[model samples]
Target: MDDYEAIRSGILETFERAVDAAGRDGAEATRRSLAEARDILAADRLRPVVLGEFKAGKSSLLNALLDDTGEPPLLPEAEEIATSVAASVSYGDQETIEILRDTDDGTPGLRVDRRGLREHGTEHGNPENRRGVLSVHIRTPSPLLRPGLTLVDTPGLGGPYLGHNAATLAALPGADAVMLVLDSSQPVLRSHLETVRRAASAVSATDTPGALFFVLTKTDLGGYGEVLADTRAKLAGALGRPAAEITVVPVSARAHRDFLAHGDEEDRAAGNLAGLTDALWAALCHRGVPRVLGGALDSLDRGVRALLAPLEGQTEALEDGTRRTVGELRRRALEHQARLAELRKGRAQRRVALRRRIDTVQEELRRDAEERHARIWDRFESHYLEEDAYLTDPQRLVAQLTADAAQVVGEINARAGTATAAVLVRTAAETGLAMGSSRPTEMAAPTSGDLVVRGRLGEKHRSGRLKRRLRDLSFGGSMGTTTGALIGSVVPGLGTAVGAAVGGLVGMAAGWASAGRDLRNEDRRLDRSSLRTQLQPLKRRQAAHISASVKDICEEFREQAEQEMEERIEQEREANQRLVAALKDTEDLTTATAGTRLAELRERTRPLQELRTRTAELEARTQAFTAAAVDRTAGGGAAGARKPEPVTVPGAAGDISWAEDRT
Candidate 1:
């Protein structure tokens, strides 16, 4: 661990030097890339999340893992469940729990305590969570959680609350590892299996497999061994891997709770908590830290190499021009011209690659927009048909749809922009390396802030006499001219059977023409058909608009990247031209002066040589760390089966102990 930190610090210091070098050379793109990579390295942590179905002992599992045994599980649990808010627990010097909630004032976040957490975040007091609870953060002093390990307790999936499922899914992609908790009494509930599958898929999609494990809770119940075996067999079969490949840590939270209550060594041992704790400690210090550190090192190596490329190349060029004669100057000029030609050729090839990449990004945006819109429409249709109570708030439907549209737009922009930006960064590096010059600015692709659907659709169109008559007919002649006028363009009548579909009102002017009074039987059928007809065109229009706008935005983003690359290439060409001109102007010189100038150039290049050596060392260390992490990942699951060796911290006097009682 100390070795990793030392290497990390050394790389970061070298990265800062590279950034400064790039900046001095006016290499804006390279500097930005280095800065971003530095921030990523500096902010990284080992995040292992606990996920499962509601009341599957997720909170209890977290408490036990953290060695917290207060009554009712240190984290909140529910007898009568409601909303499931996620909670993040980590090690701190002093114990503290804070609820992240919204307030009337437009501040960043609000912090509350255990009672506030129970009232606002738990399923009991604020089951609806109308106050908009974001997450509950808890900190405790536990040796097991040292050196920046964050344990997340996410809301249960496959439950009645869809919001909880969404929250869990949203947070899954960022988890370093997943600990899926299951109820042993229920033989691996389908929901638990589904959660595991999702975690596996998510981690696999990110190309990080073997990052998921299982924990069966309530092992104190009858048939614990049977449930564990059944779970292991099912998981192996489902995942298409060997049973031994999957780690299953069975423990009764109740036993740990009891042990905490009584402080009995036998009870703690009986709970089988020590085994899981040892496994987790092994995973955390060995597998998790290396992965995080290795990724940071990889980024650092890439950034530093790119930053130093121009200086290295220029140093090589200067050393090659050490002869002091007209022929030597002519030869240097010819070489400069040849290098410039090569740079131009490379730039042209990179431009073609950039264009192809942007084309892929554009296609992705179009497909994503269509699929997202279709999914939102499906949900709206389901809710509108199945839940009559949902019809009470037309404004809520509009808000929901609007939010969905915004999310789709935001995601599309973010993904496409990131792809485009990466291409630009690579192009910048290639151009800089070719030109023997450097740059450090980032060309950020434009976002979808202006491209997304905004403002209420109701305000776009107005209705007059035709709307009033349709309102009167649909409302059984109860709405007079005055009420119709007051209702305005949107929501022309209260009881018009518009039913709050798709932005509160859809073609109120055409309702009566398509339906008779009472809107029953065949008339109701015609009314539904007409509403679909009217809404279908509008939906298609919105969808088409979003698609076109996204395409345009993607085009603009691609164009910006192309422009930045072209500018860099131009600058490089100009700089090369000046260097060739200087060589031509200096046609003849004495050997002594030439040798002195060459000596000065060599001195200037010394830092570049040093940087090259430093980067090589960085790469070597990064590869070592990455290879170690891979080995640990391959054998981490089975680390528990063998009698564990005492793992010692670098500076600490005592070995890290998982069996030590925290209570």
Candidate 2:
């Protein structure tokens, strides 16, 4: 490889590295763009290659380069896959001059995916192949491409018509030479001259200066030279220069190769491939081949990548949003202190009702117990006599009294249970604890509290440990043996004191048994301290769980946002760099950027597009007015003049007549 080719390789390596370290979608796009730029750079480094259009002897030219004419020359005979867009190629065809023309005022546009040529069977004046695309590739054993020289074959200039030929002409920024192919039968048309001039201008302004020339095909037809001369003269008149500024050489590509080599006089032609190659080489050597297209290609790759970066970043952001991940986590702890305060108001009302119910129940129970006791006392009083008492077995008496007392206590307990449940239920109603289907719960654990003693009468009845002795009748021995001794030992006050002491002890034990049972039941009821113990673990567990989930959600959101942001920033950076490089490179390689041109174009088009729109509106209005004034079928008014250049694409960057609006 030459020094320039080596440099191209180095530049391509740099772009590869950029691709690897891109780190984001936009960056990746830029890197790939750079890769394509490598192709352009490589093209610049190569010897002049040609743009080969289809059905324009492209295949024959390509095959001849290696001097292999084995296959029958047929246009588009065995095409590859359907390539919808036009493609580029290199040819060493000397005699063929292919230049582009613009259909819109015969001017071309700057498109991206099109070449300025079409195949033989393709539509004429097709804009499908527009812009800076190369349309043909040819291989030739022609002497024209002997040294660092190449031939380019284009579709019929005006016929191919990728808009205007300006783009095809401008593409010379990467070329060292050009050839304009013409038909031997045609005249030197105005559009043809324009193509020659434009191509020359493009070459003059590029790395290689003035690398343009033309050729005429089908030379057998008469008047070819005369027409060429006439066109040259016309161009000189307009440009005020020698016609040699834009070279126009005529030849038949196959004349020598097919005519003399093959003895078929009618079929053989002129403009041999060998001769064509020699002519092309001459054109390129006229100016040293430019060796600077590498940079322009690289610049294009970078620019395309940059343009796509923002879109990639936005996609990343959208993905992050789907996960609901963000950053920063804080919990606002709001204590339900107000709800507790409200509870106090309810507690006060409940406390009053509870005390009243307790008093009423206690009074009622006391009255009922006293009245029953009195009835039992009256029966006992009637049964008692001076000598009626008798000794009985201890077991029999104990059993009888225990059974009667158990029955009566069981009855009382049943009544008390009903009364207590009713009172407690009422008290609970006044408290919010009992609201909305809620049940009053135990207030404390294990029902811990002192048993309250209230209005129950203390009754002392008699009895002692009797062994057929304490309640014994002393009628037999009462007179003789104990008259003097009884008087002395059983003094009245002493006997009474002993009996009363025994009765009091018995009453105390019985009272404790009954009261302890009721106290046990009440203690097993409501208790706040107990409820606290059960709820503590459950409430805490619930709160902790919810708090953790909230934290997890927030953490995920933050992480995703950060990831997307970083990716976006990286993409944006690469995009910006590519854009800057592209713009800079364009300015360096060309006359100027569209920056100033766009504004100038808009200024030029403003009046024309506006005028067109206004004319359209006015025309419609006049038609409507005429219709309204007509007596149902009156004749229309005089015909109107055509509207001035309405909605036209801008031309010359400032021509009002050329201004056009796309929308």
Leading candidate by lDDT: 1
**Tens digits of lDDT, candidate 2, 537-618:** 4333333432333334333433432332233334344454543443333333322433443344345334434433443343
Badly placed stretches (over 4 Å) of model 1 are 1-10, 20-33, 44-47, 67-74, 78-85, 88-103, 136-151, 159-162, 220-223, 240-245, 251-299, 306-356, 365-615, 626-663
Clashing pairs in 1: 27-438, 27-439, 27-440, 28-439, 28-440, 28-441, 29-440, 29-441, 30-440, 31-440
User: All candidates' TM-scores?
Assistant: 0.60, 0.28
Instruction: Report the poorest 10 consecutive residues by lDDT, candidate 1.
Output: 651-660
lDDT of 1 by residue, 17-44 (tens): 7678667756576567567666766666
Task: Report per-prediction Cα RMSD to one decimal.
Answer: 15.3, 50.4
Give candidate 2 regions above 4 Å deviation: 1-86, 90-152, 160-170, 207-209, 235-240, 244-246, 257-275, 286-663
Please, what is the whole-model Cα lDDT of each candidate in the order they appear?
A: 0.57, 0.36
lDDT of 2: 0.36
